[model samples]
Target: MTEDHLDIKTPEYVAIQFQIAGLGSRAAAFIIDQALLMIINILAIVILFFVMDGMETSPFFLTESTFPIAVVVIGLFVLNWGYFFFFEFFSGGRTLGKRMVGIRVIQENGHSITLLSSFIRNLVRLIDSLPTAYFLGIIMIFFHPKHKRLGDLVAGTIVVHERKAKKKKKLTPIEKEINLRGLTENDLELDDWTLKSFTAKDWKLVSTYASRFHQLPVEERNQLTKQIADLLLTKKGIEVAGKTDTDLENTLLVLYLVLKDEWEFEL
Candidate 1:
């Protein structure tokens, strides 16, 4: 791990690294959150004003009561404070703004943000936002090696870029076959109506096909794939005019995913 990155090992013994978010991205996410909160507050105030004005109660009730205004002020304060805690805890460290910016908070150990960690971080946000507009937080992030603010340091948490599982791993053979011709599950999916027509015998035949798919001689695979594809698909009005070996294999695999739930089959 370096100053700009955080590294941790999982229980599975796999090491992972996360790019630490710096001032610019964090500021962008904060601005989005503040804008959302401002909109909510303005709408709430407007709605309350209208409700009070339209009430059947006497004008004196509206004019005399400071209680309603106090309640609104306190409620907004709680809303602001709880917003980060609620989202970070329940949404696994991502708020709406964080998700939009493709960054999220996580424990220093690369675990999901725990309830206590979320609460501690959000509690210290008061200090981070002090003296107006997060000035102190900005300074800390600029100087800190890991780009950590007071809240992050106190809570032992860090913000990082989102991880993409499929992009990080080498392509598996099944995945390669599916992607070979840009074919999606939609292209191979059978409707419930058609799926219901399949009987035990059809499953047995498909099981045999799946079991022998990898063992076939490369020269004979396409020919055998065409024959099986014709028997299963063409009879059901599926157009297999120009599908290649990969396309046919992908179609069979998609079927196996569903049928294997109820029937045992070896791949």
Candidate 2:
């Protein structure tokens, strides 16, 4: 895709927007669920209180009077925590809220979230919801472009909207050769770089500058051409010592041929 045709929004920002929407949807769902749970708990407590009131046991005994209430409250708390944790942690990176909002969480590098990730993320909710609310986490998400909560930042995870249509480009023979012989996507898996490095926008910039080379002075055009070639060589994991302008042009030509799916070009 050409640069003009591509959306240049940073992935992190995009992720933030998706997360915000998802969070809103989730908050609404949580309120409803909690409301229902609260009513049930209230009714249970009332019933237990009345049933105990009619018993012959003394009302002054702390064990019988307070213990049952404590147990019920603790049980309810545990049940709520377990339900939220299990769903968010194990069910494809989304909770009931996330699923309703059409977004899912994944590792920063687009991998599936692990059990550890889920646990840490949910566990941190305690911190995120500190001092009464999740004010800390909300502050982080609001200020940061990636909308990452404290747990997400620590876990190196991101929440993104699920894209239904991912673009796929066919590789040319020369491109194939470089990928097959030099570095496949799996081979150059560097820690800092992401698929975004070779975004469609970068490709468009290179293509435009390359095609308009003749409009500039020969030396300048040659210099630009060399840069393009170096990019291609680096992308392919090819090493060329003391490469000349002509050599770079040759590499770029090969890249162009590959992008065009014309495998018959000479080096």
- Which candidate number maximizes lDDT? 1
Q: Which pairs of residues clash in candidate 2, taking residues 3 or more apart in a chain or in different chains?
A: none
After aligning candidate 1 to the native by TM-score, how far in Å is the CA of 176 from where it should be?
7.5
Best by TM-score: 1
What TM-score, computed on C-alpha atoms, does each candidate reach?
0.61, 0.46
Compose the digit string of candidate 1's lDDT tens values, residues 1-267: 343777899999999999888888888888898899999999889977876666537775765566677778899999999998999899989988899998999999998999998999999999998898889999999889989899999999999988866667786555465466565555556778887776667677776776776678977877877887898878766677788887777777666555655465433
- Whole-structure CA lDDT of model 2: 0.61
Model 1 stretches astray by more than 4 angstroms: 1-3, 55-64, 168-267
Which tens-of-lDDT digit does each residue in 172-195 have in candidate 2?
554564454453334323333433
Per-model C-alpha lDDT, please? 0.81, 0.61
- lDDT for model 1 comes to 0.81
* Model 1 CA RMSD to the hidden true structure, in angstroms: 14.1
